[model samples]
Target: MINWKYCIIGAALVVVLGMLFRMMFEYGVLIGILIPGVIVGYLVNNGYKNGAKNGIITGIIGGFIQGILVYITIDLNLPPFPAVISYILVFALFTTATSAFLDAVGGIIGALIRDKI
Candidate 1:
């Protein structure tokens, strides 16, 4: 069974982090929606029971989705449709893995804090 509360809070935190990153970076996937969603997913899945392994898996899955969405949506803000489509296949694998790891770290931190509080 999944813990909806943790998931919701973690996801919300991620969204807030994303917005903040967006504001700071102005653009780019890092501070965008990618990290936040991934972090939340990782946190939610790990719950307060199991530990890092679950978080890692959640992060990997969430990050993949986020990366793909970011890749697809980036073009919405720019021109040259082909340019956007062209790179889609390029970064998919690497970015997903990277985001997953990053989110996993965040999840660990969030879980620790959540347990304390």
Candidate 2:
């Protein structure tokens, strides 16, 4: 059975880490990916496949939320709701796509580590 709780946890972790890394190192993905991956992997004893699935979910949720926040913080003067929604979706889709693969890889590694430990 799949545990969505871990997915939500992973997403929250990624979102928080994304902010911290972006502020400190200017590179956000690394901090978000491996940490959440390992956490999900450790908490859930599923194999790498499942780990990857959860990690992808985490990336999608976290990335989209972060995207919305990013759009809000940006100086884009588009104040209308629909326009803002469109841009948010676009930003989210791009960020999710960019982060998903590495996030999945992190999941795989994390699962492997879990198995070893």
Candidate 3:
């Protein structure tokens, strides 16, 4: 069974940290990959599969929320609001799809390290 609690927790953390890193550094995506892993690190005890699930859910949810937040906070300078929204959504979907795998890999690696210790 999937652990929604950990997923939500990881999502919340990744969203916050991801935004901050995006503003402060050039390595946002690279660092963001680890946020989910760190947030779900405790679940390593549950196994790599569980860790991966939690991380992917976190990435999906967090990516969407971040997308919405970006839409609200930044002006795309597009003439049509709908166009801006659609572009934001498209980019969000792409970002989520790309990041999900990295997050799962990070989760699995975290779990392996935890398991070994």
Candidate 4:
């Protein structure tokens, strides 16, 4: 059986790392969304055998929400509609890709440590 608690813990850690990456790299537009998506993906993949779909959906939703918050947090002044739309697209794409990748990575890692876990 897989350990979901550990997966959650890993996801949490990844979130923090993502925040740090944003702050350090000064990522624009998408990384913030991508980070949360990746975290969700990591957790879902580790939690279940057929979790890829769930992970992708969860990551997309999580990333979108996180991206909205991050956008608000970063930009005090509201921009134009085009800018907002662009931001949304960039964020969605980043989250979708990053989360999918993280899901695969987490799955592999979980499998490797299954016995120890």
| Whole-model lDDT values for every prediction | 0.53, 0.75, 0.73, 0.50
Instruction: Write down the RMSD of all candidates, one decimal each.
Output: 5.2, 2.0, 2.0, 5.7
Best prediction by lDDT: 2
Which residue ranges in model 1 land beyond 4 Å of their true spot? 1-24, 27-49, 75-86
Off by over 4 Å in 2: 76-82
What's the count of clashing pairs in each model shown?
A: 0, 0, 0, 0
For candidate 1, lDDT tens digit of each residue in 1-117?
445555445445444554456557766446543455444544554453343444445445545555565566555575476865557755556666775566556556555665665
For model 3, how does the per-residue alpha-carbon lDDT over 19-114 read when each residue is reduced to its tens digit? Answer: 788788887855865767655855746788887887787778877777667555666466577887688888778767655766777678777878
Candidate 1 matches the true fold with a TM-score of 0.52
List the lowest-lDDT window of 10 residues for candidate 1: 45-54
Ranking of models by lDDT: 2, 3, 1, 4
Question: Model 3, residue 53: what's the lDDT?
Answer: 80
- Candidate with the larger TM-score of 1 and 3: 3
Error of 4 at 11 (Å): 8.9
Candidate 1 has which clashing residue pairs, if any?
A: none
1-117: candidate 4 lDDT, tens digit per residue: 434554454445445555567677766323533444344444444443534444444444445444555566667776798998788678656764665565545444443344235
Model 2 lDDT vs. the true structure? 0.75
TM-score of each: 0.52, 0.84, 0.84, 0.47
Error of 3 at 19 (Å): 0.5
Model 3 TM-score, 2 decimals: 0.84
Q: Which of the two candidates, 2 or 4, achieves a greater TM-score against the reference?
A: 2
